[model samples]
Target: MVDVATLEKRPPSTIALLEEMERAYKDLPMEAIVKQDILRQGIHFLPEAFQVIGEYKSKDYFIFSFDHIPLADLKDGADTKAPEEIKIQGGYFDLLKTVISTRNNPHSPYKMKSVEGIPTLFLGDISIGQAEYPPIPSWYKHKTKNGKFPGEIAPVIEWGYLLYLTVFRNCQYFGKDEECAYCDINHNYRQQKGAGRPYTGVKDVEDILEVLSWVDQEDQVAKVYTITGGSVLTSLKKKNEVDFYLQYPEAIEKAFPKRWMGKLVAQAFEKEDCRKFKDAGIEIYHPNYEVWDKQLFEKICPGKASWIGWDTWIRRVVDSAEVFGPDKVIPNFVGGVELSEPWGFKTVKEAIDSTKQGLDFFMNKGIVPRFTAWCPEPYTTLGQQAGPPLVYFCELLRAWKETFEKYNLPTPPGYGEPGPGKAVFSVSAFMDVIGYSGRN
Candidate 1:
């Protein structure tokens, strides 16, 4: 068995691990490796660090809890105080600016502590990096007519480059057997409600519109908006999955008529069903394939495997390319899940080879697949097991970048400018690996 005790040690340092990855994958950016390691290992903060992060757009518990620990386990109230994301720069490695989504893991080797009244990340007393929290957007200071917070209706991520609207909070993929084994969406909803936060279950259309109006009028940074929610196997508010999610984009477009780039994250639909979303004014489509290997896909995402099967899902993703055009149909895979315990690959090489096949399959057809580095939240089934090694993620990013350039694909739309130091998509480094000219 792999030793958890050894992995959790603060000696050897985060910088050392990053240097090892840098040596192995020299072509991949040092920024992407550190970003992936911070994601895989997570980060800790001193109490004073929270006070320093005071009102700078704290985490909204958007979609999933995205925490390494459960809501019930946070005795120090770090959940409420943690910043939405942190930008790392200037340390032993002389790193470029790298943005990483926050995932709370108290035992991580990387910890955020205050030094001379400023927040910094340390590895065994060595200051590996300096950190900066995203500035609170102007719209966050405004409240809706019914007294709803802007955070509840719309939350900005990627340094306010995208507005995230999780229209229906909960997924119908209920219970341990039915829901994706790696998912914490249902549990996150319950925790947010239990914590007495004003998290709306099924957000009203007008409420979303009201928040968008504020963003459109006052915010200059936001360039895209994604309308998404949990999987709806049956119906939500008496509407099918497609119809329910389609309404948000439809209403937004009708009201504003293409004011910003629009995207949708939903279950895979037939070509005809996808056309309705296109007709409704959605410019980009993300039908996340979760995992690439068939057995792992079945075991990890049981609902998707049972409902749609891998072959049908891939076909629909390709079919939708005809409707939305190849560049606009970007499917996502959860990057490191192929190495999860109980059913995943036994080694990093096998895992990367398997995922590389999926990348070639998609990109060969002019469709590009994106990924988010997996975080094992405490409530999900997979969270009961440990996540993959940092090596797996480093190798995966290298492989993904190789395939993407092999196809000579353009930068996928909706996401802001790409390449190291310029990418704002925090969850994954795929954006960080693309070539950019800084012309956003």
Candidate 2:
């Protein structure tokens, strides 16, 4: 176990950690540096900042409760008040409209404060940049016939570039031993319900279609839709995992017929199962290989480790290349988890080398894998541990960029424009580090 006393009692300053990383990897964009740090350390909002977020696109708690603190513990009502993301620009770093997913950490050094009536993000009272909350899209105002909120049903993220459809709210991965050690999906479901939020456990296809119908008619900023949920290890409804998920794409494709790019993040299934998704009009497949190191993979993702062993999971990702086309088969890694305590690497270099091997393995196959920086939520088993160092993320981004360029692969699909300030897949800086020529 990690030294919880160290993580909770008192922690190092986020800015200090970031500055050390910035100096170490000077070549990387400062935007990415701050992005990774914000993801690692999470963000805190002042009461005034919360007042301003009231007018913006609020966080929908799409899948996991990505907050460091739970909903019940948000004394100031930050859970309901926080925006889905904050776009940073015009400050010391001169950041160019960089979008970052909001992971609420009340103790974080990076605090969102108000300045001259405008909300801004500060690092230890030293203002880093002005922050902009995503404007509430017109579609968000619409509601389903059953009176479910549109924001709860189909929320958009990455600066309104992708319509996120978390079809199933709860994962079947059960308790601590079964779920990913760092995941809080099941617990998040209970907390959201306990808080009296209208969170749906299993979203209906018609409700998804209803939301899409509104999005299809009213939204232009949304270019893609991702149908994802926590792992459906067994039958969710009556159907198996693939069958249950495939129905959404089939229904959408039939209704809209390629109106938007379709992506699916699910378990690593056999090629036959993959063909079902491809046939259903899925343009991109993300069978996320959460961690690269085998021993750590087994420890971190016990459910995946037991259900679909690491070797088989990887083989399926490779097998998917034939069905989805190598370029379209993008596997995702949880970028920072390789350095988590106890089971992970003892040093940053080892972690990066292991992750790089996974990257090289896929990129060399003309298959591009992507990653989201890991957030250590308090409810998760791994939450007791401190996340990896900021330098590890900076170096990992550099390693990813180098390997991506070495193979000269096209920018992966589903995510919007790549490069600093333009990329919208905000859970990590992987998208921000890719070549930016605008969307392919």
Off by over 4 Å in 2: 1-11, 14-19, 436-440
- For candidate 1, write residues 1-440 as lDDT tens digits: 32323433323335666666667677777778788888877788768777673468789888998888887676455778888899988787777888889888787788888887778988767876788888898888889898888889999999889889999899888887779988888999999899888999999999889999998899899999998989898888899898888888889999989898999999889999999999999999998998889988889888888889988998899999999999999999998888887888877778899999999999999899999888888888887556777777767887888899899998999989888888999998899978632221
| Distance from true location, Cα of 281 in model 1, Å | 0.9
The lDDT, on a scale of 0 to 1, for candidate 2 is 0.85
Model 1, global lDDT: 0.84
The window of 10 residues in a row where model 2 has the poorest summed lDDT is 1-10
Assess each prediction's global lDDT (C-alpha) against the native.
Answer: 0.84, 0.85
Cα lDDT tens digits for candidate 2, 159-187: 89988898988888878778998888888
